[model samples]
Target: MNRLIVTGASSGIGLAIARRFRRDDWSVINISRRPCPEPGVTNIPCDLAQPGAADGLADALSPWLLDRPRLCLVHNASIMQSNRVDTLGSADLRATLELNLVAPNAINRIVIPHLPPGSSILYIGSTLAEKAVPGVAGYVIAKHGLVGMMRATCQDLAGRGIHTCMICPGFTDTEQLRNLIGDNAGTLAAITGLSAFDRLIAPEEIADAVAFAAAAPVLNGALIHANLGQRER
Candidate 1:
């Protein structure tokens, strides 16, 4: 059976991806603080933000290293803070980059060696990755770094039949979005209006994009925008 390792699979878009893959009969490994509770999904409790947290991923996955099947690595967990550059602390900025960029890169180094020829890496980015928005300086910069990392990885592994792609979503409806918007209902309204549909992007829709990228080998190294035309880049 094909195997998938998804970070931040406890909820939101991550959880949806976990469910989607499990339904397709792939062996799903979930890395997150909370358990997925979905039948057949193995939850490995982890906090990606902590120092050296990603270093252990390979050992946790060692048993499956030799399973000898198609493999996929998905980086879906992230932290977003709303603060202007002048107000963002160095500590906060470091932590954001650690989780959003460093952890995923470490996981890539660990898992890439064991990935079979058809393996793929999926980096979940955001609209902020391409364009800056007010009050989210760290997130925007880190996401931009992630896109660069994804593209670099794609180039590095392209000759080995390994695929890497960045999927950028726009204001997806999820727990993270709720927290990002806080109790300010108007902020949510304003974000939704950025898309032509005038609604928040669905986690399921992002999951579908995930499925599409995973199945299409020709899309290797592609930067796919699933944001419904929120911003053209």
Candidate 2:
């Protein structure tokens, strides 16, 4: 079976992806700050929002390294603070980058060597990378950085038989989204109104896209948009 490490697996899209992978009998290493209750999902609790957290996570999972020849790394952990740059503090900026960009990059750097020659790395991204979402500057910046990282990884890993792909999704119905919008009903309404679909994309739909990318052997350096035509690339 294929072995995959998925960050942010405690809830939302991450949890959904983990569940789907487990159901497919893939060995799943679920990394998150909180523990998930899903059976067959190996929990690796680590805060991806800390500078040193990624290294710690890499060390923790080292012993469980698979004997197989392929390792799929899915980076889905991110923290968002919806506020303009003028209103946001240094701490907010650091927190957002640490979770959304820095830590994932660090984790990939440390873990890349352990992945077999033909392994693949999947970066979860957002449509905000291309469009200006008013209140989420930091998030947009980080995701944009992630896109660059994915492309660079694809180039660097090409000769090694390793591939990189970015999976960008529009607004999805997930626990994290619920938390973000529950506090501001009007903002949520405005966001939905901006969407041509008038509804949040399902987490399962995102998970399916991820699985498809993981299994597609020839999809190296591909940016798979799962936004239902919300933001075109």
Candidate 3:
């Protein structure tokens, strides 16, 4: 049976990805702080921001890891904090890495070995994964590290038949984006204006990109930007 093991499917792009996979009849397992609202998705409650959280999930995940003909593991959970490089504290940075970086590594150790041929490991990155934006120093740092992780995974898993890549989404329309732009038309406009499309990308679009990446082994080690073209300043 084909399966999709994804992190942070409770909402936003993560939720969309889970639903997309489910539509294709793949068994979906979500690991996140809250359950995915979608029917037929199996949720494993986890607070990924807490250090060592994924380590304790081995037993809970063992059943799903067994004998699957195809598997797709997506590292999608992430945190973005508003802080400048000068103002970013080590503790604050560590907290971000715990979720955005370390948790994925921990889960990879547990899941990668069990993956059968025709499996894929995908990382949900941001435009910030490659470029720096002000007031989100921690997020930028963690995302850049995620790119490196994806590249390393491709190299280390060579000849294993498991492809890996990072998909970077630009200015996506999600609940989180709406909350950040609350009651501010200018903020929304400014964000949309950055995109050549002059609109935020639908979560489903990014989900579609991920679904494609899962089946395209030729894209291994590629850093794909699913964000509609962004106009440079």
TM-score per candidate, in order? 0.96, 0.92, 0.98
lDDT of 3 by residue, 1-233 (tens): 68999999999999999999999999999999999999999999999999899999999999998776699999999877789999999999999999999999999999998988899999999999999988999999999999999999999999999999999999999887888678899989999999999999999999999999999999999999988999999
Please list the Cα RMSD from the true structure of every candidate, rounded to 1 decimal place. Answer: 1.5, 2.1, 0.7
Over 4 Å off, model 1: 231-233
Best by lDDT: 3
lDDT of 2 at 93: 82
Residues 1-233, model 1: lDDT tens digits: 99999999888999999889988899999988888877899888788998789888777878877876899899999988887898889999999998999899888888888888888899999878888978889999999999899889987887888888989998899998898779998988888888888898889899889977887778887788898887342
Candidate 1: worst 10 consecutive residues by lDDT? 224-233
Return the top candidate by TM-score. Answer: 3
Across residues 108-185, which tens digit of lDDT does each residue of candidate 2 receive? 877887887767799999877666667877888888888898888888887887877888888888887888788887
Residue 162 accuracy (lDDT) in model 1: 84
Number of backbone collisions per candidate:
0, 0, 0
Rate residue 231 of model 2 by lDDT.
28
Query: Which is the better candidate, 1 or 2, if ranked by TM-score?
Result: 1
* TM-score of predicted structure 1: 0.96
- Which structure is stronger by lDDT: 1 or 3? 3
